[model samples]
Target: MTLRTIVVDDSIIFRKVMRDALSAIPGVEVVDIARDGSSAVDKIVAAKPDLVTLDIEMPGLNGLEVLEELDLRGIQTNVIVVSAHTSRGAEVTTQALSMGALDFILKPDNDNAGANLAQLKSELARLLKMVKAQPQLSMVSSSPAKSETLSAPIVARAPVRTTKTTSVPRPVECNLENLKTPKFPHLCHAIFIGISTGGPKALASVIPKLPATFTIPIVIVQHMPPLFTATMAKSLDNTSALNVVEATHGMPLAGGGVYIAPGGKQLGVKADARGNVIAVVTDDPPIKSCKPSVDYMMSSVPSSIARNSLAVIMTGMGDDGRDGVSYLRQNGCTVWAQSAESCTVYGMPRQIIENGLADFAFDLDDLPNLLSQLAYRAGGYCPVPPIPSTTAPMMATN
Candidate 1:
């Protein structure tokens, strides 16, 4: 199965380089190349290739505008943004994700062209595999008009609950009775989310829909680079009723706030003397090739916290959160996965479901309400006992 592909870039050299790289990947055919955005859009709408490598900084009709135009015209195709490492590039790449690109690869800045192309080729291959595995590639426009932040009521969809019997758990009937009468008298102390590919758009759909009065402290590890995570956090904060900020060391993990783990650092939580959980940012090495890894963050969750936390594994390209989720579930944490139909890449969530670690799985539209309900109705607001200072001393973890 040859994946028809297009390379869209202003640089003649990069276009050729990308073409050669794509050719090296098995089953990828370079159907066409466009020198700029207008030509790229025209060629795309005409050829309708299976994949496109887009350069975000085209001279006219930049990559973002091209995505907007495609959304307006209802064109369906997988797009991988080839982006520079500049601040502007990071900002626009974040926007591109929210606008519905499947994923992105950073343009290597090193002068060694061979090394750069090798990295690009590896990243592109991974993203292509993710795109090919998706059951559906068509997507609705993520523009403001179609955004889920409006007052439209979300109709409940039945959640997918599974129990381990074999290697991969088979879905059983959703038992609302079981959900309501869990062993724990309440839902959770905190909500921890792990997402990667297609995360920005998904998070945009969820975080803003959460009511301002909802007070559960939500911590997120969205696999991204440094500047990219900060930019994404700012974007979410602008639209969200809940205060959203990039997690910093010593920051209090309090209610009514959403903390995004900083991109290049490991984020963990430790209880302060005042009983409030505070952020712990460390220069730890990457876990499973991901800095600020979901595993690292969730592993840092204390047993007291884990026993009462809800771990959400959403759309992503890899199984970074699986081990962490395993630990959490073992400690009595409840786990939820975003359903395949709602995920851009079902890799992460599928692992949870397959490993029998998921307590529930839901569509993107149904999650915000479910989270709010469990957080508010299930006695999630029990306040932490007050202590002295908001900050806590960082502790070393083995």
Candidate 2:
């Protein structure tokens, strides 16, 4: 299927360059080009392109203004921002994400514009794949005889728990005997969780059940954009017993609180001169096509949490957490993954479970109870039963 696209930039040369690059992509066709944001908005409405590449610094109407116009008109076209690498540009790009831009690409320096143009082609191809994957493009009609409905709402649900607590709760007694514990003994000082796809819902189910007295600091990397992440964090904070907020650079990961990696920035934990672990947000290149990537967070755990870390990989697309899980396992940290049956997308967890990287695999429904048990254990939590020799096969669910 061919994806119709529009390129919007004030620079005549840059607009042509983007048009030529996009036109070269296999399944993408440049349907229109606009010299500025005003023209872009008009052409977008008339052409109704499947995707839009917007320049951040356009005159008359900036990229953000164009997005606001689209929002006002209820146009849900996929948009990618082309921005400079200046601090102001980075801030603008981040703000654009908060305003619902899909993603942003750094503009190449003037001296290396040619080389950068080559790189932009590959990036545009990646963006095209992401655009095709969006739910909005599913409405596009290929045949002239077929009618398309572009007015439907994109069904996006905030992550929330589906179950209610019963008056009579069954309690499972703790049995320390006959349990095979690790020889070196894993201690979790910080808990790192990587989730995507149905993460908000999964987090809502698990986080609210955690005790306010739970001491270990928690850090989460949920695949999402800025506004979505902000909304999710607020939702979690309101529902869960613990305090939750979008993570900021240099902030200390405090006990009994949850820190969510803000969207559009790579979040990593690093130790300071005083040996205190602090959150670091950077405009570093994306890992596995995500800024607030799971791999980035998981890779930083060994150094931050040292041998006393716990890592969990939940439902998500791709193998972002596989290597990070492996690293944690090798460093004597406990790593857990969601069972396939409980996942919206079984990609990340499947990789770890199949590769023997995960120490325990549990269904989503069982996670809250298991975590409660661990939290109640003496000298921190531990999984009751050891991992089976073979992994349980996982399946995708809505």
lDDT of each: 0.79, 0.68
Q: What is the C-alpha lDDT profile of model 2 across 205-260, one tens digit per residue?
A: 78988888776678999887665566667777888888999999889887777999
Best by TM-score: 1
Candidate 1 residue-wise lDDT, 1-398, digit = tens = 56789999999988987998899999788989999999999999998888889998888899999999999998988898988877888889989999899888998777898987888788888777666555566422221112111122122211111222112234444543333222332756688999998999999999999988888899999999889899999999999999999999989888889999999998987666666878999887777778878877876776667777789999986777777788778778988888777888777887777667777878899888888887767665554544456444333443
| 34 Cα displacement, candidate 1 (Å) | 0.7
For each candidate in turn, the TM-score is: 0.85, 0.55
Regions more than 4 Å wrong, model 1: 138-187, 385-398
Q: Model 1 — which ten-residue stretch has the worst lDDT?
A: 157-166
Q: What is the C-alpha RMSD of each candidate to the true structure, in Å?
A: 8.6, 13.7
Backbone steric clashes in candidate 1, count:
1
TM-score of 1: 0.85
**Cα distance off (Å), candidate 1, residue 93:** 0.6
Clashing pairs in 2: 159-200, 159-201, 340-394
lDDT of 2 at 115: 80
